[model samples]
Target chain A: MMTQFVIRRVLYMIPTLIAVSIVTFLVIQAPPGDYLTTVVARLEAEGQYVDRGQLDALRERYGLDESVWVQYWRWITGIVLHGDFGQSLVYSAPVSDVIQERLGLTILLSVTTLAFVWAVAIPIGMYSAVRRYSVGDYAATFVGFIGLAIPNFLIALILLYVSYRYLGQSVGGLFSPEFVDARWNLGKVLDLLAHLWIPVVIIGTAGTAGMIRVVRANLLDELNRPYVVTARAKGLPERRLLIKYPSRIAASPIVSTVGWLLPSLISAEIIVSVVLSLPTTGPVMLRALESQDMYLAGSFLLVLSVLTVVGTLISDILLARLDPRIRYGRR
Target chain B: MVESPPPLLDVRDLRTHFATDTGMVTAVDGASFSVPRGKTVCVVGESGCGKSVTGRSILRIVDAPGRVVGGSILWDRDGTGDPVDLATLDPGGPDIRKIRGDEIAMVFQEPMTSLSPVHTIGSQIAESVRLHTDLDDDAVRGRVIEVLGQVGMPRPESRYDAYTFQLSGGMRQRAMIAMALVCHPRLLIADEPTTALDVTTQAQILRLMVQLQAEMDMSVLFITHDMGVVAQIADEVVVMYLGTVVETGPTEQIFTDPRHPYTRALLQAIPRFGQRRAGRALSIIPGSVPDPYRRPGGCPFHPRCAQARPGTCDVVEPATVTVAERRDVRCVLAAEEVHS
Candidate 1:
């Protein structure tokens, strides 16, 4: 039964991705002018005006002269058949090659941030709910509200100034100056780790606060449930009873949030990335859209949408595993 | 009757209070009762009477903002060992935990919500067994299945892995009973276990509980508002009003010769077959249970009692008086017998 469900879910993703790709293609096309117009305008501004013939040649070479349908067809088929996401008009390189390093770094940062969020939020949320209205709970609630209220970029700017001023240390980006262009090595990896904390903290603060509230609210609802009392009456220790019953049930919403989290790996914290000067996908995608680099921007959105679809599938499977009612389709 | 064995659980002046935002609301106030060994005692009361809280207090499973404030739950486990005051034990300490499911287990009212939806019945039942016993996995499973079968769960083997939502209302209650009984506790506190079920299912569950009580030789403290259920399963009855036990005696005696005005009013409220006339309405106790925060000065039931004397019953609290063998009533009218 589980396998069948998974198979069906996987099959459903095909049409979903197709629809998402078409929408992404059209939205990217809807804006006036193409990448060539920006290039021509830039050349003109630089006092090196291009002739119409050269501009038309450049447009033809990049397949920008084609209709929207033909262009979308080429792009989609190239991605489906050859895994080619077209060429990045801004970088003058293949879209995949341009994004490969940034994509890896983004995923690494997102995964670490997610881990930090869960590791800190879950225990604190459970504690807050279990000992509600206590001193510790009040403190957590106060801090959580602050975290949720402040913008991530403002937090990023403040942390950067603090570390650079009082600590006399620069803490921005995912690497120090020495390892900025260095090859993959133990030293570079160690340096990356040393510089990773700031970005992780800034990106994770809001999520952790939101997650804590979710877990606390969900757990509070479950704590007073009769099942919890039954478990307590069964002599289960306070901690075990909490983790084994209410906490497990309370985690369902958190599990379902994975669908949103996966896409955030590619597009979250855009302004923060720009402020910190981190070589992550968020900033690159931002520049691509601003420059009307349709191929690069469209590819980025398509990948994000696909991740969303796949992430939803993963969360559904996990939810089924966690709740037997969902797995058995029983009320 | 051949001399009954000593009471398995003795509760004395149990006072459980909840520290709500409004104030400290005393849910169970100075209530006293005892459950005789190997017999069923039903605590009858309307809503807000604190019958459920009284049972929860005995098990020390009252939710947050509520706790047993003052009480001595003397649990005589084997009828030979010195009774232990359960109320004094730290609710979360090891001593009380050791006693919670090993010697005393509880089944709650909502069978649907009282069992965790995420866990299978066998696993939930096995959890208690594992906590209290040294049984191996197979033995724990064996014991769980045995109890499930004893509780009349259909096809216990196949039903073991079923979730509570998958089971019918009757089956869910059976699963709950199985969970409570898996450890072979000396006492079982069932707080309105059948109140959520249909009438047919209620009868089946009550019958199953009675059968298991006999087979396991365990005392049961059943809490309910249903007088018919009380008459059917109770060997002894303790009627409570506004967190206080107003009358208590053997079931037959309480039914035949109720001494307290509240008890008599409660009995009169039950709708009997063929007793309803064309226009005459069924009798109901006048007034509702008083708010916990503003309990009346003298008798809590004075405003609701039919025979209350304004000067006497409203000014002075009535003391419990023994009017007959093994029967007690707290009422100004019953106090006259002691004076005589």
Candidate 2:
């Protein structure tokens, strides 16, 4: 039964990705003119006489002269058949290469941030719920409210300044200048770890705070449930009773929302990444869109859409595993 | 008849209060009763009368903002050992933890919500067994299955892995009963265990509980508002009003010779079979249970009691007056009978 459900869900993602790709292609193309226009306009602004012949040649070279349907067809087929995302007009390189350069760091940052969020949120949420209205609960709530109210970029700026002023060290980017383009080594990895905290903390603050509230509210609801009382009556130690029952039940909502996290890996915290000077895909995607680098921008969005679909599938599977009610499709 | 065994659990002047935002609301106030060994005692009351809280106080399982403020839950585990005052033990301490499921276990009213939805029936039942016994995994599973079968769960072996939501209401209650009974507790406090089931299911569950009480030789403190259910399963009946036990006696005596005005009113309120006539409203107590925060100064039931005397019942609380063997009633009229 489980395998069948998973198989059906996987099959459904095909048409979903196709629909998402088409929408992505059209939206990227919907803006006025093409990447060539932006390039020509820039060259003209630089006071260079751009002849119409050179402009037409450049347009034809990049397949910009093709109809929208033909261009979309070519791009989609290339991605399907060759695992190619086409050449990025802005970088003068393949869109795949541009993304690949940052993909590892982006995934690392996102996974670490998610790990930090869950590790910090679940315990504090459980504490706040089990010891509800106590001193610690109040303090956690106050801090959580502040975290939720402040934007991530502002948090990034504050951390940067704090490190510079108090710690007497500049904490920005995923690596120090000495290791920015250094070859992979233990020293560079260590430096990466040292600088990783700032971005992870800033980006994770809002999510951790939000998740704490989610867990606290969900746990609080579950704690008051008769099952919890029943467990207590069974002489299960308080901590075990909490973790084994309400906490597990409370985690369902968190697992169900994990689908949103995948796309957020590349698109979320754009301003924070820019502020911290981190080498992540958010800034790259932003620049691609601004420069009307259609291939690069479209590829970024297509990957994000695909991640969203796959993320939803992953979350559904996880939820099914976590909750038998969902696994058996019973009410 | 065989002489009644010594009481398995004797509760004395139990006062459990909840510290709500407004003020301390005493849910169970100076209520007293006893559950004799191997018999069923039903605590009958309207909502907010603190029958459930009284049961929780005995088990020391009252939730946050609520606590057993003053009570002596004397648990005589084997009818030979000196009774231990459960109220004196720290609710979170190890001694109480050992006693909670090992010697005294409780089943809650909402079978739908009382069993963890994420856990399988066998695992939940096995939890208590594993906690109180040194049983291996296989033995624990064996004990759980045995209790599940005892509770009349259909095909206990196949149903072990079923989640609570997969079971019918009756089946879930049986699972709950199995969980409580897995430890072979001396006292089983069931707080309205069948109130949420359909009438047919309720009858089945009641019958099952009664049979289990006999087979396990365990005392049951059953809390419910259903007087009909009291008639069906109760050996002794304790009628409570606004956190106080107003009457206590054998079920037949409480039904036929109710002393307290509130108990009389409650018995009158029960709809008898073939007694309903078209166009006539079913019998009911005159007023709802009084708000706990704003309890009446004198007798809590004075505002609702049919025979309440303005000067006496409204000015002074009645004391428990023993008018017959092993029967007690708290009423000014009953007090007058004793004095006269």
Candidate 3:
């Protein structure tokens, strides 16, 4: 049954992704902005105002002289046939190659932030639930509410000051200068991770406060489930009842919410990453948008959309596997 | 268990309550009962009547907002001679942990939610055996197959590896029973375990419980609001009111000579074959359960009770008094003793 569900999910993804790609291509190409104007503006800003001669040469060189329809068709065909995502006007490199170079760092930050969020948030959530109505739970809950109230950028700035005030040097930055100078060996990796930890924690901490509340609500619901009472009545150890039985029962809610978490994290990361000047996807994507770099903005959006769909698909498959109630094609 | 397995389980004054925002809801208000070896003790009540709460409290499963404020849950254990108090013991405590599968187990309502969807039945059952016993793989597998067979599940071997989604409602209930009885727990706490099953499946599951109880010499705390099911399974009947035991007696007496008006009303409320109209269906208790937050000043049910003598019953709480050798009821109208 699990295998069949996984297969069904995989089958569902093909059409969904294809539709997403088509929508992305059409939306990106049809918008008023094009790659040529942004490139011309960047040059003009650098006091290299393009003459009419140069503008014509630039337009023809990059295939921007073509009509929007022709340009989109060419872009789509090139992507399908040669995996070409076109050249970035800003970076002046293949879009795929630029993404490849930066993808690892973005994933590292996202993965680290997520892991940290779960690690800290789950415990707080459980503690709040376990110590319901207590002073400590109230305090933790109050702090969590505060987290919701304060934007990540403001929190990021506060953390940056605290780090700078107590600890010497640029503790605010994502990577250490030493790590950048050192080769990408184990020592450098470890150093980079240590430096990266601060920003990850800042983003993670802010994000998890809300999730802590959500997890608590979900767990409370599960705790009230009839099976939970039965498990307890069986004299199953408290550990088993809470973590094994109720937690598993409550998992799908937490798991399903992860899809929403992915998008939220991108925006939250935008706040923290911009404040800290981290080399994370959020800042890059924001920069691309602000600069009106259409190819870069479109590619970033396309990648993020794909990630969102894939995340949701993963949640669906997990739900099918974990929940006996959901049978593919059965209901 | 030396004293002939000592009533399978014994419970005394199990007072469980919830400390809610509005007020304390006495869920299992001083409930006390026992199931003799191989006997089924059905706790019957309305939705808010604490039948399920009592079962959960006995299992030491009362959660936040609800707690076993006072109680003693003594259960027969295979490895120990003396019965242990499940109430004070942490559910994760070693003694209770060891007893979960090998000496005591539970089955839940809504098999869809009761069984973890992520795990295969085989593994879930296997986990029970693995956690609670020192049995080897072959022994565990053997026991799983045997219990699955005992529950009347078809294709035990194939079904073990199957997820719950693959099973029919009947099969799922059987699988749940298999998980519960994997180690032949001396006592089984079944909380409306068959309410979600179809009529045929419900009958089958009830039969399986009765048969298994006898085979294992187990006590059963069968929680339900269904009088028909209560009639089918209960050796002893405990009828609860808002959150207290309104009446309790032997199954035969409780059914044939019910003293409490609530019990009488509940039993009559069950629809009879020829007693129903087309639009108006089953008879209902006069009113809904009193909201716990703003319960009536005196007897919680005084507002709806037929036997309530306006002045006396609408003003004071009734006490549990002995009606006969094995019967007790909390009714103001019961025959009172006169002092010289």
What TM-scores result for chain A when each predicted structure is judged separately against the true chain A?
0.91, 0.91, 0.87
* lDDT, candidate 2, A45-158, per-residue tens: 889887999778756754687888887887788788887887676787888889996877887888898888889998899899989999999999999999999988888888
lDDT of 1 by residue, A25-83 (tens): 89877888876776777778889857999778766755788887887887788788888
Per-residue C-alpha lDDT of model 3 across residues B88-109, encoded as one tens digit per residue: 8865567666766667777888
Question: Using alpha carbons, what is the TM-score of model 2?
Answer: 0.95
The structural similarity of chain B in model 3 to the true chain B, as TM-score, is: 0.91
TM per candidate comes to 0.95, 0.95, 0.81
Give the Å shift of residue B202 in candidate 1.
1.1
List residue ranges in candidate 3 displaced over 4 A. A1-69, A76-103, A171-191, A257-292, A306-331, B1-6, B45-47, B71-92, B224-227, B230-236, B239-250, B253-324, B327-340
Total colliding residue pairs, candidate 3 = 7
Candidate 1 has an lDDT of 0.88
Please give the ranking of all candidate structures by lDDT, highest first, separated by commas: 1, 2, 3
Native-to-model Cα distance after best TM-score fit, residue A87 in candidate 2, in Å: 2.3
Lowest lDDT block of 10, candidate 2 chain A: A261-270
Candidate 2 CA-lDDT value: 0.86
- Go through the candidates in order and give each one's C-alpha lDDT: 0.88, 0.86, 0.77
Q: Could you tell me the TM-score of candidate 3?
A: 0.81
Candidate 1, residue A218: CA error in Å? 1.4
- For candidate 1 chain B, which ten residues in a row score worst on lDDT? B272-281
Computed on C-alpha atoms, the DockQ of candidate 1 is 0.88
